[model samples]
Target: MRYAQVYFLFLVSLGMVGCETTPKVDNPVLGPPPPRLKSALKQQKLKHAEIASRANDRKNILEGDFEDSENPFETPVITASTTSAESAVEDTEDILSDSTVVAMVNGTPLFVSDVIGVYNFQLKQAEQRMPPEEYQKLRRALVKRDLKGHVERQLLIHEMKSTLKKEQLDQLQEVLETAFEEERIPELQKGLGVNSPQEVEAKLNEQGRSLYSERELFLKQQSAIQFMAVKAKATSKFSREEVLARYKANIKDYEVPSKVRWQRIRITYAKHGGKDQAVGLLDEVIHKLQAGEEFGVLAKKYSDGTRAEKNGQWGWTRRGSLAEPEIEEALFTLPIGQTSQVFETSTSFQIVKVNDRKEAGHIPFADVQGKLEQSMINEARMKATKEILEELHAKAVIETMFDLDEDDVNSTNSAGP
Candidate 1:
């Protein structure tokens, strides 16, 4: 089953999806699992991305069903690669401690397990979607990238600590411990087949996650992301001139495109008529419209395009955006609530009607000030976060043990631009 389908099963078990919207993409913050519980959840035949993508509705999993349900960590920050396949690996207990060290930051040891923990979930999901040869290449790429991510995370935590107040750290640690002990740890214990905290510690230790290390790892990640979010949200407000300058720079975004609420009676040559036959058929359609036979009824009966299902309704379309430029020009010139002259394109003969019209125009900046300001703040936060990560990267003394062959580097480019 697809991850979405499996998430639905979890939702069904919880009886929480009643009329709730299912989000199609994972939240930037929540869908990637936390390092400690990622592999644990995968063992339950569940996935953090599955829950995080739908974090908006799965309130109990993140927050109560309110507008502010955000997962603290988005998958991208951890995976360093696109897939979360590492989460699928069963916790070997000793992988991090047993393997050769991949990297170190600030003289602190970095192990393969740390990188593996972050991506096991991503890897699991990637395997389901890709063929084996490609998956193998991606898995190798993720190991090197996420190994760096592990180091970056440590550096970020080091930077973030200087910003948070001692009291704030205390409070955050309290909340993290409470959540883990009261909720997350119990869920993990059950999933890992342990009945007591000591057994849980022993099992995790066998896998290289002693209780202290697990708590510290969880706390460090949570603190860094939370602090990062705080910095992102603390962007200074834009001045009036700045806002106006932005408005001018992206003026087209605020402008309303010329639009027509319209419908089409498309007579494709192959289905309803051929060549001259298609033109003749459209002429007959126009003649019937002039004779007062209902356009919607005729379209329902004979129109072969998708709009036939909606009585030939195109609803609303913007100029320059329609598939048919000829029909677009004809319709824009046609008066609202009136039918156009019969028009032919390479593929179909169309009889269109303009139900309504909106002339192209810019939205006044005064009217969009609030929206523009919020957008500015969001952009600032993202920029700020990127800059902060880069700065931390520059300051960290880091080392890596792996390098991709040329084929792996080419795969990254081939995967996208």
Candidate 2:
């Protein structure tokens, strides 16, 4: 459980999570641009400088009915400065300090801002589920663990620059230019001082990156995206039988955990009053039920929970999944269609009725066949992509400026961001 492996999983899991969540794509964004776009790639190189000079022309092209292709970068990301007008003015040239230099990959500086920005990106997925002290410990080590992946990316870019054909690079640069002009500029215009080419260059200068440097970055970023897409496509050619075999080998993944469906009436102890008031509320609910008042009407009126409108009928849930262990235990043991005694649990005083239950079993193969195949293909693609990264990391000379020990890196990586 090295940090390297965790970091690898961290990266791969994003691509795979995307695979699971999104509808089965004919082509993933991580893969290559479509053929029609490929056919239209300009053979002539477009200088970012030339692009800068022709701001109005580029604007025209953008505003033109020349239906732009799907931008691989999709939309350019917002920088720290342009987040607000005040932030843009105050943060314009001050965000990057000497400490911003976190690492170097083959003489290229990797900024603390870059590391933190990337870390925050992952944090938005979910908070790192660790104790406060552990989270602080992991936070210091987070950037260190991610450095290798970033280094590998730079290394791949270096190699791409050296290996790709003049025509190919030119085409890529042109494609990058169009994407910037069309998608990025509009996004940039929404921020400060980016309305024209001069202002755009000024903004880059303030940030210590010019059009040239930004183009290099775009080249690298797009190259990384295209590389993943290409590798994914190559690995995605799995035979139907191979996919089925993969599904068979990992049958546990398709298991339906034994679950219980139950109805509940919860009276909040935390909200209205202490345990006594909660008990009083629960007593009132029970009397109402005894008087033949409907559970749905009672829940919709008083219960503070999901399925309250469905008369407190919580959907089927597997054992150990419920937050309140005692409640789950009570529900499992309670007779079908019979109410439980008013019991004080963690957050509330509640009564329950078991509606239905299901035993643990394998999901029908037909039900999950498409999902299984997609998952298997994505897994293979992720594996191939990881191999590519490992190769790049092996060859890259990477060094970090910050003091972070191997142990901390390992701990953070294994646990993730």
Candidate 3:
């Protein structure tokens, strides 16, 4: 396959990685506000002053000083500062020089910091996946690739903004803010145990770092997929037939793993007179099971498990699924008709009777048709996005003059202080 085909295939396969394994999607910090509007405002203020001066000049000319050259307001046009525009342009240019400038479609002031922020996040991810020695070697290259990707995304975002309505932006902002405040923040705080507003802020700040990291991850994924979607639109005209074809080609990608329906009962060692006492109690429960008392009734009374009321019955066991080795071992070893001896887990003490077992099974295709269709849609979108980015890369005047030395971190642009 050609490089482009290989690239496209790699991008397609990337979608299959589990979200947990994927870097958390972090949103870019709105950051200290962009200076574009501020610059525009200052220019407007100057323009207003010039207009007033011109009006006065006209009055003076009408009053009799006919000197056109000396006129204080010769047409009072304040040329917007080229310097400011150039600075803004250069800031974006510098980043885009070594990276892909997707498109400044929306006229939003793109920032190097935003792309750099994203690059740092991807670097951290690379560091996590590789060994220390390999990470040190590959980190800069990885970061550069990430920056290239982000700049391309920024271009796409700019394009999207140009076409997208202001109300849409407003609606998106409102929805995201609601999610951040009402859902994400509260849940984060609850998990982190923040009580007061101050603690909440502090916790969020800590989480904010994490959030930013994840946002970069999210941006890459989103930008990649979006770039593909936009590309596919221009490349292969996707018809219902093509969608069906793509759907058929990638149907296996949509299968959900079989799940075992089961209930759990836990016996708390602390509640059952500490670990030693719990152990002794286990011996007694075993004896009762031998004597033929109903396992379910005894479990309801004695198991300190959260699901104790239901009985110490975990309905089924799927191979290689359970995290606890002891419980999993016992589940597989115990005869289907019998009960397990009291086993201690990291959290508590427990005895379980496998009231039933459901063998792992494949979900029927008809049952998952809707989900499969959505998967096809997403896949199609990705294909289109990749084509868009390839075009963007082809058109962009990217330059990577900056040295990325692995050994001399101090000399490299990527070096950390």
Clashing pairs in 2: 31-229, 296-311
Model 3 residue 336 lDDT score = 59
Which of the numbered candidates is closest to the native, going by highest lDDT?
1
Q: How accurate is candidate 3 locally (lDDT)?
A: 0.49
- Which of the numbered candidates is closest to the native, going by highest TM-score? 1
Instruction: Please give, for residues 1-417, the per-residue lDDT of candidate 3 as tens digits.
Output: 212332343344434333344223342212122333345434544554555455555655565543335675454332232224434443223222122322221234433345454345455677678765466446434445454455556546543443334554344344444444555556656877876545666654543345544434454444344434533653333455655665567667644443233334466677876778667777776788789988777778777745667665554446678888777766655655566666667667666565445444455555656665676666666666655655544433322223323321222211111
Compared with the true structure, the alpha-carbon lDDT of candidate 2 equals: 0.58
Name model 3 segments beyond 4 Å from true.
1-146, 153-231, 234-293, 300-310, 320-352, 400-417
Better of 2 and 3 by lDDT: 2
* Candidate numbers sorted by TM-score from highest down: 1, 2, 3
Q: What TM-score should be assigned to candidate 1? A: 0.53
What lDDT does each candidate get? 0.61, 0.58, 0.49
Candidate 3 to native Cα RMSD, angstroms: 21.1
**Full candidate order by lDDT, most accurate first:** 1, 2, 3
TM-score, per-candidate, Cα-based:
0.53, 0.44, 0.33
**Better candidate number, 1 or 2, judged by lDDT:** 1
